[model samples]
Target: MKRDRDLVARVLAAKRDPRCADDLVRDYLPFIKAETAKFMGRSPQQGRDDELGIAMFAFHEAVLSYDRARGAFLAFASMSMRHRLLDFARRERRHADVISLDERRPDGGEGDERALVETIASERDELDERQMREASRQEIAQFAAELESFGLTFLDVSENCPKQQRTLEACQRVLDCARKNPELLDRLLQTKKLPMAELARGAGVERKTIERHRRYLVAVLLAFTNGFEIIRGHLRRIVPAGGDGR
Candidate 1:
């Protein structure tokens, strides 16, 4: 009971700090490998096998999604990994079907099959687009759930978000400060609320402005802090002052 309680606390901590998530996953590497080996019928090589990579991604997803309501963390993670393994199998089978087009056929000439493969590839653009869409959907769903914990939603965020360029830049200062000092985020996670006074001071934004746009700040902060990968993919386009926006 005590060990399970500690793990639950650790998972909640991971939800607050991205680095905590990394460390938690590192500690569970043996368990993750065991799960991958179960699916693979042999031990998965750490860097060489795709199965290990998929299992790690699944474990990360479990970290992001697990709550006390979900019961034990490992059981939840095991299920997530199993589902991903099944998805990987399906994707591999589809890839095999497409790649087999390059195999020598007794009747069909190489030029004829090559042309067919090209036409099909152009039409489907198959692999990358489909994978990206699926990944984006999952990220959006998880982000939405996280936002809800703070009594915010996508529509609420959209309506409350700052419209003016200057106001937007002020909000950016808050983000910059949080990036430098992650304690604000840790407080938000612990209390399920933002530290407005300290945040405003750190970012040099007026406290009134922070109050005016609390939900927007919360949404953006949560997205950037946690591992909402696909949803926060636009971070590259947001450049800093006098920087290359990298």
Candidate 2:
């Protein structure tokens, strides 16, 4: 684990220096290939496949954008590669066509094709719903564990969350402060406490307001700093892209 972190730090440093970029890419070529192969269901050819090219570019982007707050660098890089491959497939219309209901039955009988179609659709819906529920459950479990590290629980977050728009905005201000200042987040993680004074001063919000929403602010800050994707996705509607806490 320490080794991976060291390598990620090195790659990030290399990203900032043009002279080291090529070496960084060369060293991590296997990683790029593995990520691509995971998505493609087959080992990607280094120089023969377009997906490899896209993965290489995505890996480069990951090195450039990765931060300590965003969790493991390899996980981020894999996600970046997967998303790029998915987007490329979408643009190229690479998805397989649906099987035709009119095709001859494998049973060598005049099967009820319409019934088969309905059954397939119903099963697909059930499977999709099950997968989504499982994913949500896992995300919540992981989030709860993260919250525990800061002496918090899901119940605490729910009960302490601000209800009024004004208070909520104030909490968002604290979150923005933490997000903008990595040092603040590092301090919070190191001390296992919210930097209320720092956050209030940096966000230009009243100290009293920061104290009142301390729990909520801590939860929100942890979500951003830990790269809680599901939580962040859910908050997208509440938080503005400009980070104004609106």
How do the predictions measure up, each by TM-score? 0.61, 0.64
Stretches of model 1 off by over 4 angstroms after superposition: 1-5, 8-120, 239-246
* Candidate 2 structure quality by residue, lDDT tens digits, 1-246: 568657766877877896676778788898888877766769988669899999999888877877766655665566567667766865454222245544443444566334344455555567556544544565577668778877888788788888999887777666776777777776776677888888889888898888777777777776666545656788877765434322
lDDT of 2: 0.70
Q: In model 2, which regions exceed 4 Å deviation?
A: 1-8, 14-61, 69-94, 98-111, 115-127, 242-246
Model 2, residue 228: C-alpha shift (Å): 2.2
Candidate 2: residue 96 Cα off by (Å): 3.2
Model 1 accuracy (lDDT, Cα) = 0.74
Cα misplacement distance, residue 80 of candidate 1 (Å): 12
Worst 10 residues of 1 by lDDT: 237-246
> How many clashes (backbone atoms < 3 Å, residues ≥3 apart in a chain or on different chains) does model 2 have?
0
Q: Find the 10 residues in a row with the least total lDDT in model 2.
A: 93-102
The local distance difference test score of each candidate is 0.74, 0.70
